[model samples]
Target: MTPISQLSPRLLWQFFDTLCSIPHPSGHEAALRQWIADWAVERGLDVMQDAVGNLIIRKAASAGMEKRKGVILQAHMDMVPQANADTDHNFTTDPIQPYIDGDWVRARGTTLGADNGIGLSACMAVLADDKVQHGPLEVLLTIDEESGMTGAFGLAPGLLQGDILLNTDSEQDGDVYMGCAGGVDANITLPYEAEPVPAGHQALRLTITGLRGGHSGINIHQGRASANKLLAELLMDISQHAELRLSELDGGTLRNAIAREASALLTLPADAMDTLSALLERRQQQYRCEFAGIDDFIRLELAPATMPARVMSTSLQQRLSDALLACPHGVMEMSRSMDGVVQSSTNLGVIGTRPEHIHVQCLIRSLNDEGRNRVAEMTAAVFRLAGARCNFDGAYPGWQPDPDSAVMQLLLDTHKELFDVLPEVKVIHAGLECGLFKAVYPGWDMVSFGPTIQGAHSPDERVHIEAVSRFWQLLVRVLKQIPER
Candidate 1:
């Protein structure tokens, strides 16, 4: 069946359906990039690709609108690769199976790639439409935005020559995003040694599950229980109240997402098993009550295990547990200017103990370079206090909004002219390529807006089919209303 016939808002359904038939997961966007070029060439548009695989497709101004200003429409081509553990969808080569669920478009057991792919589709749809009125248009499709933003970061100077840029990457439809938080990935490591344990000690597995994990920046202040922190706290309590030897500890997957589940195998004295189980039950009840609103599914369970007797030394175990507890996670600071907005945050997303090293990964974000550095320093300080060696990489600046920007005024006017209602302008908590683009093209005015997308970076990701039409309508109005310089 044709995609347009399967969903509402014909243009959006057609665009989204075409996007799903391609595999554009982060770091695997070569095919999508080439496809975009082919699509542009088919329309007789001038398309070019940067060395780092950023596509810029140019279309002339609509008839009678040639005197209007030129505008750049930007969207990333990559999507976060995520799937339920039970899902067999392979992101490396398989196309996203976009299906309609009422007004939303979702994939089958995999991420829908609507986070930015929808934005890309919207831009492409506008480019192909011969009837849509607009100025000189340039569509920039960047690669590798989900994982590292390598395409934006690696953009060669002087490739784009637009004075105003519209980033179609925001998740909300009514909100106009002008600023985003800067971020850095901090990697921490600790030395550890595992040895055979006494024969009398028993093995037990401790598991924490059902936590409501989300985007660290968007949901950090919600107090959702982190699986890594929960497991670490329980182990610390056991390490203090009872004699416990750590055999293996592992939790979390991505370094950016809050851990939802964690498991630890350890050796404990047979005499202490009953007391430990009782303590765990009490703690679980206490935490359930604490996170009742944020994570109603929080669970902690203990069961016997048949693991080998090898274990980490008590000293090493103490150090690791202390570090995990001390390292700060979640919202660290609130925005001074924006009410209820997070200014800076850190996510203790992953923890694992290997044969020779205990590794921890944290994602830090802030609106300013100084604030980002502050959070990074705070995290490193905690690691240092716990005697762990810390390292950091992949640092990028934040996009600062200009309240009096000429393009912002044009957008405000255009939005009002089309809908008779003003769009809510604000900053977003997540990281975007706007920050990197600003660095490359200083003095360029930029704003981001998109259709409603939910559950990004997760399997439940979906996009509102109707919002795409609204988004397209607003974007076309903005382009047509651009004033001459």
Candidate 2:
């Protein structure tokens, strides 16, 4: 038995343990999908796979419950792959090692994969538990939800017969998400010339790490520092005083995650090394003070390195640095309709420099299409000024809230009856698969809720133990209370 199996809510945790044993990172979910299919087949449940790798498992209504409305339980199968810089774990081959930390479950120096894993486990438990009373059920397990909404985007119309969708992709416990933000990815490439390294210059690698990088859309309001932007600012400032030539620069991983670490290799005048070190120290202190409470663990280091054969041209380096420094990040606008809800935001998610060109990726999100487009255009304009080509792709629509949604009311009433408090109903700033499903099934009443997950999309991700139990009780009760069709 696994450590997770010993946790409370044995069925859900047992399924979660099994899931953690199979490597299911974004864009690589073949094995996990097969496992889920086999699990359903062994139990004699009807299963179907769509063209995009989405799995739909069906279970007949319980005795005396055939007249109740059918419910579709939805969760994404893939998880964002993130690990500490020094961790040697590989997302493709290594199984996530989830361990209990007090009242939470976390992975060592890597993401715990609990954002949707716990939710997926809950659905699996429902399917396997014969005692759980419910009407006809369809479990929709999607793929590639972390990196792209490929599964949701390709869902065919009329594939599901349920009138209500219960999305289990939400992170918070005491909230029922009625809607979510839409998002688009902006890819920018800047062509640059390489020049021979000048004589009498020393090479140094400047590294910025330990920042609390998090989900771009969900945590954008927390004021966490972006390593890419900070490195650009530092490079621009250093170039003003010293003759610096950039050789290589890279940071970040996923386009939807805020950059946590960045490093730049450059050659600078040998005589100015001391002054450059002093400047970096001062700037680090300044940033620490500015981001005191939110990302106080920020660190900047400088180390001597061997010289490179070629470096970026002075003009191109300056242009790239300036454009990155000018790029917009964090929350840009707040919604007037929903109090304290972020309306529009952008994350300077990644930066990479190669011999021929430099690449910069940004993720823009908004509650409305207009806000999303506005930010994408603004980001493009900034890079275009620096002779970079910018293009937006992988765009998805937002889920519009239905005030009269039957599913939402049912979930709310179930929560109040189970926990003695009403679960907050609000729109999320982050993208959820429910939006894409709505495009395929426009009339399906939808609501999203799940166990409490913190530090998602980062190495620090974890799930609350007690919250899972409460979440399970609420889900089971909601299933038992569905109105007759």
TM-score winner among the candidates?
Answer: 2
TM-score of 1: 0.93
- Compute the lDDT for candidate 2: 0.92
Model 1: residues with Cα > 4 Å off, grouped in runs: 1-5, 270-273, 303-309
Q: TM-score each candidate.
A: 0.93, 0.99
Query: Over the stretch 381-446, how does candidate 2's per-residue lDDT look in tens digits?
Result: 999999999999999999988999988998898899899999999899999988888888988989
Looking at model 1, report the run of 10 residues with the lowest lDDT sum.
1-10
Q: Write the per-residue lDDT of candidate 1 for residues 1-485, one digit (tens) a residue.
A: 45543564466567767777888788888887887788789889999998988899999988987877778899998887767656788888888887778888788877888888777877887887788888788888888876778888899888876778999999887788889998999999888777778677899999887775766666677787899998989998887777788988998877767787789999888999889989998999999899888788787888999976578877778878888888889888899999988899989888887778888999999999888999899899988987889998988888998887888877777778877889888888888889999988986789988899877776777788788778888887788778765
Candidate 1 residue 482 Cα shift, in angstroms, is 2.0
Name every residue pair that clashes in candidate 2.
none
lDDT top scorer: 2
Model 2 segments more than 4 A misplaced:
none
TM-score attained by model 2:
0.99
